[model samples]
Target: MNSLLILALILFGFTSFYFGKSRIKKVTEKGDLRPKALPHFYGYYQALWCALPAFLIIAIWTVFEPIILKNLIENKIQISSLNEISQDELNLIYSQIISFSQGNFSGQVTKGIEAGAITYKNLLSISQGAKVSLFFCTIIAASLFAFRQINKNVHAREGVEKTLTIILFLSSVAAILTTIGIIFSLLFETIQFFTKINPLDFFFGLGWSPQKAFISDPTNLTPQEAKDLKEAFGAVPLFAGTAFIAFIAMCVAVPIGLYSGIYLAEYATSKQRKWGKPIIEILAGVPTVVYGFFAALTVGPFFRVIGDSIGLEVSSESALAAGLVMGVMIIPFVSSLSDDVINAVPQSLREGSYAMGATKSETIKKVIFPAALPGIVGSILLAVSRAIGETMIVVMAAGLAANLTINPLEATTTITTQIVMILVGDQEFTSAKTQSAFALGLTLFVLTLILNFIALRIVKKYREKYD
Candidate 1:
C-alpha cells in the first residue's frame, strides 16, 4: 500500500513536468515568439511548482501526524464517560492503537484502541491520496494556464527561465539550510559538554584517561575528589596520538597513492586501467571491522616481535600498527580522486610543454603537477578528513590510554576513542564525560569543514588561471 502511494506520487510528478513542457512548446510554436523562458525550463518550473509544495507538506505531515493525532485522540479518550483512566492508561491505549495500525499488535484489540487505529489508517490514506490528486490537479491546471498565457507577444520563454532560476535558487538554499542544521546540532551538544566539564580542563588538561572516568565506584566522589578529575582529561596525549597516526598513515599512503594516481591519469595504458582500477577499488569495499582484528591480532603482535629484535620497546597495541593499516585502507581514496583530477588537467598544456623539449618528468613536475596541484591537495585533505574520522583501527590496535606522552610504545588514545569510551558503559547523560563526546565530535566536524573549504578555494583559484 505504501509502495503504491510512492509510485503514484512519482508518476504524478513526471507526468506534470513533461505535459506542462509540451503544452508550453505547442503554444509557443503556434506563431508565438515570446514564450516565457525555453519550453524545457517551463516544464522544470511546472514540475517543481507541482512537486515541492506537496512533498514538503507530505514530509511535514508524516513527521507530526503521530504526535498531533495522539494528542487529539488522548483528549477524546480522557473526556469520554465510557472511560475511567489515568494518563498511563491513555498512553497504553495510544500505543496499542499505533501498533495495531502498523500491523504489529496481534491479540484481541480493545474498542477505543481499535477505533483509534481505524482513524489513524484513514488519516494516512486521506493524506497520501489527497497529495497525489492535488499535485496532479495543480500541475495539469498550471500547465493549461501557462499555455493559455503564451501568445505572439507574451515573452513566455523569459518567464519560464525566471521560474527555473528561482527553483534552482530554492534548491541551493535548501542545501545550505541542511548544512546549517548539522552544524547547529553539533554546536549545541558541544555547548552542553562545556557546561558539564570545565572548558579549560577539556582543552588544556594534559592527562588523557577517559576510560578511568567510566570505571565507576560505588561511593560517589566528593567535589574535591571530582576536582582531581582534571588529571585524567588530558587533550595533549590524544592530540599527539592522533597526529602520530595520521602522519604515519600519510607517510605510507601519500607517495603510493599519489604515484598510482599519476600513473593511472598520466602514464597508464588503457589496458592497465581495465583491471587495475577495479582491483584497487575492491580494497575500499573491505569492512573496517575486518581491518580492526587484522590490525590488533596480526600487525600489533608482528610489530612487537620486530621491535623486540631491534631492542626497541613495542606495545602489542602500538600506534605504528594502527597507522600502517589505516594508510593501506585509504590508498584508494587518495588514488581514485587524484586520478580523475589529474586527468582533468588540460591535455593542451602537457602537449605544449612536451613540444618545447621538456622531458616527460620535467613536463609533469613543472607543468602537469602544478596544474593538478589544487585537485591533488583537495584529494589529500579529503583523505586526511577520512583518517581523522576513522574509529575502528584506533579502537582496536591503538590502545586507549589518555597518557600525554607521544612514545609509540606507550598506550595512547584519540578523540574518537575517548568518545567511544565515555559513551560505551552506562553513561549518565548529564555528566561531563558523556557531554565530552559532543565536544570532540564538533571539533572534528569543524576541522574537516575548514580543510574542505581551503581545498575548494585552491581548486577555484587554479581553475581561473586556465579558464
Candidate 2:
C-alpha cells in the first residue's frame, strides 16, 4: 500500500514537470510575445499547482484517518453486544478490535471479535487505497489541464509563473496556521487541567509539592474523589527553580560569552578567529546527556563536597551544578549570536568614531556596543529560553524535591523537570499527575512566548534606530 502511494506521488511530479516544460517551449517558440518569466518558473508553477492541494488532502486524511476509521468500524461491526457500552468502554473494545484486525491480538478472537476485526481491516484497506487512487487522479487531471492550456499558440509561461507566486505565498500562510493550531491545542488542555484544580492555588501556592496530594493509585481512590486537584500542583517551586537556575546559568555564561564575543568581533584578527572560533563552538557540540552525567555524577557531588568544607549545607543534587553546567552549554549560543550582531555594525560607523579621536575602548563601548545592543539582547533572550526549557541537565543534576526555597546549595525542580517526571515511564493520562504535566507544559510555552515577544520588540525597536 505504501509502495502504491509512493508510485502515485512520483507520477504526480513527473507529469507536472513534463507539462510545464512543454508549455514553456510552446510559449518561447510559437507565441509572438516575449515571456514574462524564465522556463524554470513554469515548471515550478505547474509542479506546485499539481502537488499542493493533493498533498494537503493526503496530510489531512492521514491525521484524522485513525479516528474516522474507528468510528466507521463501530458503525459497521454487526455486534449488538457493544451497543450498551459507554464511550470509554467502547473505545477500549475498539482498540482491541483494531489490534485483532491488524493480526496482533493477544487474546482468543471470538466470532463477534472476528467480525468487527474484519470490518475494521476492510475499512483501513479501502481508505488507504482511496488515497492512492485519488493521488493519481489528481495528477492526471492537473497534468492534462496544464497540457490543454499549453497549446501550440498559448501564453502558458506568463499564466503559470503568476500562479506560482501565489502558491509560494500560500505555503508561507500554512506555517502561520500550524502555529495557531499548536497554541490552541495547548490552551485547551490547560483549561481542562485548571478546571480540575484551582488556578490560584496552582499559580501562587508556596507548598511546592505534587506527590503529596496526588491520589497516586486510582484503584485505591474512594468512590467520591475530591475536586480542585490544582491546589496540589504548585508552580511556585518550579517557577522559582527555573528562575534560580536560569539566573545562575546567566551569571556563569553572560560575562564570559559577552566578553569573548566582543573580543572576537572587535579585537581579534582574522588569524585569531581561524583557530579560536571553532574551539569555542566545540563546547556547544557536546551532547546534553554527557552534560547530564557530568552534572549528576561529577558537578553535583563536587559542589556538595566543596560546600561541606566551607561549612555550608549542600544537597546531593544542587541547582548550582545544573545551572553552572547549563551556562557553559549555552555560552556558544550567546557568543555566536552576539558575534553576528556585532559584525553587522557598519565599519563606516566605527571609522567615524575613530575620526573623532575616540580611543578604541571608548569607541567600542559607546558606539559599537550601542549599535549592536539589540542583537545582543535578542541573543540573551534566546539563551534565557534555552536555560528555562533545558531538561536533561536539570533532571539529573538538580533534584526533583520542588523545594520553593532559593538556596543554590538546596535541591530544586523546574517545570521541565516535573513534566519529565510526571510523564516518564508508566503514566496514566486520566490522573492529575499526568494532567499536571500538560499544565506545566502550557506554562512553559506561555513563558517562552512572552520572552520571545519581548526580545523581538526590543530588537525591532533597536533596528529602527540603526535603519
Candidate 3:
C-alpha cells in the first residue's frame, strides 16, 4: 500500500508539472500577461509543491506509525494481562504478537497474544489508510495553493532555485555529519584498542599474528601474556606487504598509463581518439573482483609455471600477480586523468615551442609535460590511493600470510587483507584480536589522510607555478 501510494504521488507530480507548464504557456500565448519566469520554472514549482509536501507527510507517517502501533499493542497487552508485566516481558510479548501477525510465530499462542495480534493488524490497516489519505490531501492542497499563486508577478524561478539550494545544503550537511560520525566511531574504538595493546608495539612491532592474542584473555593478562600480545600484532608485515604491492602496482601503472595518456591526447587521430578512449575507460568499469579472479586463477599459475621452467622459487599466490593485475585495473584512472590534464595544456605553448624550432617530442617533453605536471602528479597520487585501498586482488593473489618481505615472488598480505581476515568470523569485540581490526582501520585512515594532504599540497604548490 505504501509503495503504491508513492508511485501514485510520482505520477501525480509529473502530471501536475506538465499541466502547470502548459497552463502558463497558454496564459502567455493568449496575452493574459507577460510571464515572470519560464514555463519550466512554473512546472518545477508545481512539481515541488505536489511531491515535497506529500513526501514530508510520508516521512512523518513512516516514523510515527510503528511507534503508535506498538504503543496501542502495549496498551492492549496491559488490559488483557492479569498481572503487571515488566518492560522486557512486555517487549517479548509484543515481538511474539508481531511474529504471529506475520505468520512467523512458532510457539503456542495465548489468548492475550491472539488479542494483541488482532489489535495490531486492525491498527495497521487504519494507520495505512490514514497515511494514504493524508498524503493525497497534502499533494492536492499544496498543488492548489501553488497553482493559485502562479501569476504574472510570481517568482517561480527564484522559488525553485531557493528550494533546490536548501536541498543541496542539507545534503552537504548530512554528508559532513556522516563523515564526522565515522571518524569519531573509529577514534573511539581505536582508543579502546590502545588501552588493551600498547601503541608502540602496535605501530612498530615486527610480527603480525592476531591469533596468538585471541587465545588469551585481553581483560586480565599475565606479564608474559601481555608481552606475547604486544609482539603478536607487530603490524610491520602488513604495512610492508601493503607498500610492496602498491609500489609494484604504481611501477607498472605509471609508465604505461602516462604513455597511453600521451598517445591518446597528442598522437591519436580523431577516429582513434573516439574509439581508443572508451576502450581504455572500459578497463575502469571491469569489476575489481574479476581482476582478482584473473590474478588468482590465471596470472598466478602462469607466473608459477614460468618460475618453475626457469627453476626460480615462486609462491602460487604471489604479490607479483596481484600487483600486476591491480596495475592493469588502475590503468584507466591514470590514463583518463593524465590524458585530460595533458590535453588541458595550452595549444599556444605547443605552437610557440614549434615556432622556436622544437620538435613535437621536444615540445611535449619540455612545455606540455611541465605545464601538466601538477595534474598528472595528482592523478598518480589518486591511483596510489586506489592501489593501497584494494583488497580483493591482494586477498586472492597475494595470499593472507603477513610475511614481511619485498620479494615479489613471495606471498604476502596487506593491511586491508588483514583487517578483513581479523573481522571475517564470529568475533569477541572486547578481545584484542577483534579490536586489532579497529586499530588497523585507524592506521589506514591516517595513512590515506596523509596521502590526500600531500597530494593537495603538491597540487597547490605546482599549480601556482604553472597556472
Model 3 Cα lDDT, one tens digit per residue, 1-467: 77887898899989989988887877777876789998988999989999999998888888999998888888877887789888889899999999999999999999877888888999999998888888889988999988887745378999999999999999999999999998888888889889888899988999888888854556787888877888898998999999999999999999999999999999999999999999999999999899999999999999999999999999999999999999999999999999999999889888999999999999889888889989899889989999999999999999998899979999999999999999997888777888888888889999999998988897777663534
TM-score winner between 1 and 2, please give it: 2
Candidate 2 structure quality by residue, lDDT tens digits, 4-38: 56566667776777778767777667767555566
lDDT values, one for every candidate? 0.76, 0.80, 0.90
| lDDT at residue 268 of model 1 (Cα atoms) | 86
Cα-based TM-score, every candidate: 0.74, 0.84, 0.88
Clashing pairs in 2: 197-230
Can you rank all candidates by lDDT, best first? 3, 2, 1
Candidate 1 Cα errors over 4 Å, as ranges? 1-3, 16-50, 74-160, 209-221, 273-275, 282-290, 293-317, 344-357, 399-411, 420-429, 449-467
Each prediction's RMSD over C-alphas, in Å, is: 5.3, 4.1, 3.3
Alpha-carbon shift of residue 307 in model 3 (angstroms):
1.3
Candidate 2 residue runs with Cα over 4 Å from true position? 1-19, 30-36, 78-83, 152-173, 189-196, 214-231, 282-287, 305-313, 425-432, 449-467
Q: Compared to the true structure, candidate 3 yields what TM-score?
A: 0.88
Question: Residue 46 in candidate 3 has what lDDT?
Answer: 89
Off by over 4 Å in 3: 1-5, 27-31, 60-127, 151-153, 215-219, 425-428, 463-467
- The per-residue C-alpha lDDT of model 3 at residue 322 equals 95
